[model samples]
Target: MHVLETERLIVRQLRIEDAEFILELLNEPGFIQNIGDRGVRTVADAEQYILNGPVASYQQNGFGLWMVALKESGEPIGMGGLIKRDILEDVDIGYAFLHRFWGKGYAYEAALAVLHYGRDVIGLKRIVAITAPENPGSIRVLEKIGLRFVKMINLPGYDEESRFFEVDF
Candidate 1:
């Protein structure tokens, strides 16, 4: 079920129908490099990705990445929501957008909405966000949402360096 909606965005569950858009967004050059290589080559693969990733998280954790859509056009722009990360042992806010939507504040808008939902609605005491040290843009979004830098840590199952940010409700 959809949990949150903003003026220009709707935060809802990732459906099988959203696979094609997920493929395109995950394959964006900046998304691949900055958000890690998802290898979402085909719509079928994207469907499985959503099932194994966000959908499973929702089933297990009660919260997961949401499909972010523009209300005016009803176009899926990206995803943003709370995720349970192995390193944090708690939920964290994560987001991604297509390259075409870069510099448009869509990420910020969607993320703020999700953050509030995770805190006030879901009753999460604290949420964390992890990003590559070099991805300043993602870090900025975390900051804009009131997350403060906590530390640098290597994520389990990931060899790359990552920075952790946190916010307490």
Candidate 2:
């Protein structure tokens, strides 16, 4: 189901049928490098990811990463939304888009919408984000969305420290 929309994009919940797109996206070199490999090697694995990740998040937290698609063509371009990581104290916003779609304003647009959703709709008092320390692109988007740099954090299970950012409602 559709969760949010921007002038140029539609943000919606992930469904099993999105396996193909998810498979390709999870395997993107950039995704693996920045977000870590999800080990989704097949469409079936993507299906499981949807069911176990986003779908489960929606049920458990009332919010999760949603698919970002071109508003006009309904073509999937990326995913963005709020994530509640157990390792973090506050809910955080997360997103990943295809490499082909990089350099566009979609990440910022979708992130802005999701940040508003977390505060205004979900009544969250604060939202945080963590990005690979070397990911300047993501850091730029986070700063653009009003999340200020807090510090570098070493999240559990990660090999490197992440640049932590946050915004208070």
Candidate 3:
């Protein structure tokens, strides 16, 4: 995918150099409890995750999670983009950030950019987002980006309950 830039972020494909940041972000308490407990402990494990997850998704599906970076320092701060889920039956926008970046509108900024790209650049007919039913912050981000509530459903690859949201192009 081509690199996309916002005022404060640069959204691009994952690289091997990003392993440390990825591992750090994924192991955060909020990420473990809310997003899932993937347990990426080493740089090698994080590299494998980028290969098996985002890079593989892009090769197979034409889109996947983007590495979100701070524009000024060119440091990776998070990831936010679309993923084709085998169980969800659609391409869904997913995002996660370091705790330090929370409450600063970074999620909203990156998400809105991805949403626009999915519709205008990729020409997808629709896009979806799913969050744990209790994750009010994510739900608010979906709503803030203009996705409407679709329904409650069991999460794919997870045993938890989730609320699905979608927006049609």
Instruction: Name the candidate that leads on lDDT.
Output: 2
Predicted structure with the largest TM-score when compared to the true one: 2
Which model is ahead, 1 or 2, in terms of lDDT? 2
lDDT of 1 at 84: 85
Q: Residue 157 of candidate 2: its Cα lDDT?
A: 95
After TM-score superposition, the amount by which residue 50's alpha carbon in candidate 1 deviates from its true location, in angstroms, is 1.2
lDDT string, candidate 2, 1-169, tens digits: 9898988999999999999999999999999998999999999999999999999999999889999999999999999999998999999999999999999899999999999989999999999999998998899999999999999998899999998999987
Q: Which pairs of residues collide in model 3?
A: none
Off by over 4 Å in 2: none
Once model 3 is optimally superposed onto the true structure by TM-score, how far is the C-alpha of residue 51 displaced, in angstroms? 0.7
Q: Which stretches of candidate 1 lie over 4 Å from their true place?
A: none
- For residues 57-122, what per-residue lDDT tens digits would candidate 3 score against the true structure? 889987899899999998888999998887877689999999998999999999999999998888
List TM-scores for all candidates, in order. Answer: 0.95, 0.98, 0.96
Lowest lDDT block of 10, candidate 1: 83-92
* TM-score winner, 1 or 2: 2
Q: Candidate 3 — which residues are off by over 4 angstroms?
A: none
All candidates in order of TM-score, best leading:
2, 3, 1
